[model samples]
Target: PLGYIKSISFICYPFAYGNPNKPKKMSELEKRQIEKGDLSCLINNQQDANILYKRIIKLYHQRDMVYLVKPKTLRYWLKSIALRDANEVFRDLVNSGY
Candidate 1:
């Protein structure tokens, strides 16, 4: 049956592609791969740098369109970016002797 709208009751929702709210089930190998990608990015390994970015794009329809990246790969990409930023901050703090 098609979804219907009630006369008095209404449901307001955000438009999202795929199952964004689904819980991700990551294998030990996948987890390690993501971490490895993060490390590689930190080390300036551009070859495997986009591994996580590709994965995240898979998770969402928007991302997988152009590059067709896997959700798992995209996640690693994101992790790497966050780690890179955090590392910079840490370095700055250390330099300041904080």
Candidate 2:
């Protein structure tokens, strides 16, 4: 349907739209760090984790292709490690009242 096609197009178009001031691509290390951050926050259920995951995925690959895996695998991983780390940091932050 036209709506579906447009939805796909909307999702797909950003990789081609570059900001002139920004570099065309990020280094692999930078990308990995980003994914690590997302994983941490997602595990913790941090407020920004979903947004971070979406951005990190977008930075590295297309959204549609990323979903070929069984659903919820990434969520499980996030909960396992990243979430725990995020919770510890958040708890420290709150306890410190910073």
Regions of candidate 2 where Cα sits further than 4 Å from its true position: 1-79
- What C-alpha lDDT do the candidate models reach, one value each? 0.33, 0.32
What RMSD does each model have against the real structure? 18.6, 15.2
Model 2, residue 20: displacement in angstroms? 21
Candidate 1 clash pair list: 52-73, 52-74, 52-77, 53-74, 55-70, 55-71, 55-73, 55-74, 56-74
- lDDT per residue as tens, model 1, 1-98: 11211112111111232355642344456444443454323323234646532112212223211111222233434667657644754564468565
Please report how far candidate 1 places residue 31 from its true position, in Å: 35
Query: On a 0 to 1 TM-score scale, where does candidate 2 land against the true structure?
Result: 0.21
Best by lDDT: 1
What digit string (tens of lDDT, one per residue) describes model 2 on residues 1-98? 11111121112112212234543443456444533443433222334636423222222242211111111334533546555644654564468564
TM-score per model over all chains: 0.22, 0.21
